[model samples]
Target chain A: MARRQAASAGTSANEAAPPPEKRRRVRIKPEERYREFVSKAVELFAEVGFDAGTRELAQRLDVTQPLLYRYFPSKGDLISAVYKEIYLDRWKPGWSGMIEDESEPLRTRLQHFYEDYTETIFTPEWLRIYMFAGLRGVDINARYVVNVETDLLMPMARAVRRELGLDPDAPIRPEEVELFWTLHGGIFYYGVRKVVYGFACPIGKEQMIANAVAAFLDGAASVMRGFAAEDASAPTAPSTRRRSPGSRR
Target chain B: MARRQAASAGTSANEAAPPPEKRRRVRIKPEERYREFVSKAVELFAEVGFDAGTRELAQRLDVTQPLLYRYFPSKGDLISAVYKEIYLDRWKPGWSGMIEDESEPLRTRLQHFYEDYTETIFTPEWLRIYMFAGLRGVDINARYVVNVETDLLMPMARAVRRELGLDPDAPIRPEEVELFWTLHGGIFYYGVRKVVYGFACPIGKEQMIANAVAAFLDGAASVMRGFAAEDASAPTAPSTRRRSPGSRR
Candidate 1:
């Protein structure tokens, strides 16, 4: 009787109490919530990797575990979403056009393109997730490599051939692909060294990209000249020549 | 009485119950046992990573946990031994002499040196352990990078300068170091792609190294010629120039 009297006294004192609207759950669109979960999950996965439990993710998202599961059924499904977002969705369509833009000097175009590309991908989130995915033995890295080869490397090879006065339609050589990968991998390694391994890179990103592009173009030109010289000195039998690897396109 | 009779019957069947000498523990020198433990530990760590427990290691070594601790004292101590063996002990003293040998062509020398170096390091065991060490936030990878830069990259820069008819004792440009790293990192990435990521490289090791070295030499030569041409035309003030990072050496 005393407790009831005290509760009544409290209610009487706060006769101007607000309605229950403040305690109600806020409604959000499903698509918007899904996007929010993916963005937040990318950060959490990058920070703690796939080993992070769903409880941790839920805490980071400020949501209940059941709410997180409502969006992503499992941790692997969430990681798959992250892979798609990062590797597949993040590629700007204009990059291909920029690479093939013959109006600009190839060196300037390459410099601008890589600077922009690295700006997008050289972040701690991207690099760490990439390493984590590779460590987990996922096919995402290999798939991304194949995408890079087909989308970027092949076009770059054709451009190099065009600059060298070789037939643009001619098949690309294995050596050519390897040389391009050397430059590309070198730049990527700089990111790995700095972002992943936490090493200090003495030079800025633009400077490194510029140096790599200069070296690649110059070296490729010299190699092409050597090939031209060899062809002039002794015309080889075309029948014995091996097919170029780039002919598949 | 029945148990006693059974025991006596078993002893009688064995006739002599072979002397205790036949069942005695085999004695091994402490130092030999320590070396044996380290060797076995390296294999286990390489296969399973530094997370392998002391009990696991002991089981692999066919010894008791107490016996394993007698040599390593702790897991960290065993990992330290592994770092020493892989990074420091595996380096061949003759590699420095090979790089300095001017009698052979630079291409041939680079090809031979990388071939030998890769043979030592490109194994699955070494590559996985290296990645594991890096992921574990150990100083081993950083220490190894410094060793490579000082011992290998610096000497290579000098050789490139000499080849370009520049002063061999002159400061190595950041560009020079980057170019060398491009070649080195590219080659290293090839090993990573194959061993760690389980990707198949279309080209063999020898071909890839030859292509990279050839590209590097040609590129460095062309870049040097460009610098010379610019200096001849402009005659810029040398005092205003920024020093190369390698000048610290």
Candidate 2:
């Protein structure tokens, strides 16, 4: 009875093993597979845009269509994952601290921060994907802009005020935000012109950043002095109450 | 014989008239048709982007695919036509003269110029197509940027210098270019954020432009003063010789 059972099991194993080499698949762990899919998908999306078909992506990934579906159920899901990785995950933790460190000259801090920041976000992939999202009318670009304005530009403006010997805790002015956006947008446009639009900037990136930072610092100091002069000249009315304790009237 | 000929002609005419309504085609002049095609194509391209299929555009125009092909040999040709119409054709000839008119205060000149300029290019269609062309890696955007810098910004920088009692014919400084770009780019980003990216700005368009222009003029004057101070303090090196007759060393 034992010999008969062993013979039956051996026959079933042989049937299962027939043409096994052709049917075998590489066994990637599920977590590893999901990450690989996102990485490859980002490249493909950045190359051809988010509208590229899954068949092309699957072909690029050298995987079956079903395999891609197993990782990301829909194209939108994949795009959301891509946005998270590109916008959210890529931001460095120490960037805010770098800008706020007060020990370094404002020009050096700005120049260094932009050099590092641009290195992370100013690639063709980042700029193209950003424009792609904007053109597609996705809110991702707007949300990212808000994040930059609030987290980066706002703090940088306060830092600029501090560096210029103004009260850092003063209520931020619209002109201050606009000025920061000018410097930030000017530098960002350098990337847009170079990476997205493929224009050759007459100046290299480092020199451009240095020049922009120097001009910004100089301009900010002058603007602040003008503000002080205006305050001194204006009649103090009841409406002239300061919004912040440390704010200049 | 005449009666028989008339009878036969009437019989043929009667036969031709049976489906006359269905067979008749609108007799649009070729020039009119070409203009109509271009106008419609711009709207469609601006709406859906350059990657939109020709068939879809033809459908939108209520014409056949062959008719569109008759007007434009290829999609690329159609896009070129769109670029020419949007970027080149829309520019007003009087804009440079407006900026160069130093009789008016520099603030008024800049304000008027930008208002007119933004009205021409800040529509959803123009901004969208501009971004689309940029993302598609087309030279339209780069060419447009160059045109704007040359026609608008270079002259504006000289105007600012003139307003500050500096020589107008001086060789343009990189700082001047970058500063003008900051102001120009800051305003442009306002349109991009509001119209293209659909972000709500804290201020209205007119207010934003007013703030940006005021900040720009003030910062520019400040920057010029700093340059003058630096020039006064620097050693009279041979390399510091003026490149232009109006330039200061």
Candidate 3:
């Protein structure tokens, strides 16, 4: 997508780099060169799909394939580096702490967390690379999904429980996780519309996040209560753990 | 994505097609051949991506380039057929009727509409092709986004207004449309996780749709009322028209 170019295209440093022999003589730092490889890999992978060969990547970086290989032993290693650079590295360490911060109201915490969270994940390269990695059926998607579940969605589910004055220690149900996903997924779809689908999000990200969090908080209590009520009546219900009665016709 | 193959890799009909010369002599029906071309194109485009050439597609179908061209004058025409077959043709006409059916409670209508809608759109092929096209910067995604807004999201927004006992014709604010998108996008993200990212959705589609609809409906009233209050207090506020104060920190 041309929008992706807007993010990584600002740097002409690679294009202006000295010839391979001259750069070798100048002796770039190994760690800086490694970081350069990862960032440039993000741009290249975002521009072309993940199927791009290292030969193409090295050419674009103005470095020899051997030099690229020196940093990343293989394509898979390079891709993992890209995933860390784009997805994992961009995640704010303060997010989970924000979600569980009891001093703030749930709405304020959620709104602020998402507004800040979207700021990191909402870029063109991040969105495109994530989609490209998923489309290629890489483990990057699955791994990120788990991180979101454990670090983000599950913690928010507990936050919702505590916010509603329900027992925070009560085992979080699959239905509860599903409920949080509606809010998380809804906000994510805004990013997809803006970055992936190249559609206008009309509402700016701040307003969109606020509207989503407000709507979700409004509906969450009763839905959770519905789950609680169902659990109370049939403590041993086989299907209760797996599916919500509300989902049925 | 392997899940995509699960949907389209069913029949060996193409694999067993007669030799091209024999097939030409056998004289396949024009409409039947056109339909075959479209379905096969979907499978191939979903597998390799939209970058596939006419020659490769014809070879996959066990037909000559000339014969394939007879059905679709150009590659774009063929791609258009795939879009129509996968996207437009899959939309059920009765969805809007279901959404507006006041005899049913708004939650009931929404839960039912989404359950049925997700069934139609949540396939692996549909999910992958849409992402692939969007990644390639095609108009298919833009067109589908509009269709979702005008045909689906706007109607649901209006439905939310009607459900909340507001003026159904109350000139739907962008905030209201975005509120509907939170629900719509949440459900759509479930599909993305399941189909595009190849992750387990845990809850079934029916439950996911139900949970999303319930949450959106739960919060929608106050959110809409908040909009109504803002509009009445400041009829001509320029900033009010563009951004929701709820979105502000």
On DockQ, the candidate that comes out on top is 3
Write the candidate numbers in order of decreasing lDDT: 3, 2, 1
Question: What are the per-model DockQ values?
Answer: 0.18, 0.15, 0.46
Give the clashing residue pairs of candidate 2, or none. Answer: none
Each candidate's fnat: 0.35, 0.31, 0.72
Question: After superposing candidate 3, which stretches have Cα over 4 Å from the reference?
Answer: A1-27, A53-56, A64-76, A236-248, B1-26, B52-59, B64-77, B237-245
The backbone clash count of each candidate, in order, is 0, 0, 0
Better of 2 and 3 by lDDT: 3
Mind giving the per-residue lDDT tens digits that candidate 2 earns over B1-249?
A: 012244334455544553334433567899998888889889988887877878888767677678777877777788889888888889898999999997888777887888888888788889998988887766778888887788888899888877788767756665566557767877888888888888876655565566566655655676665555555566354123222211221
The candidate with the higher lDDT, 1 or 2, is: 2
Error of 2 at A127 (Å): 0.8
- State the lDDT of candidate 2 residue by residue for A85-165, as single tens digits: 898899887888888888987777888999999998789888788888788887889888888887788789888778677
lDDT of 2: 0.73
Top candidate (lDDT): 3
TM-score of 3: 0.84
DockQ score of the complex predicted as candidate 2: 0.15
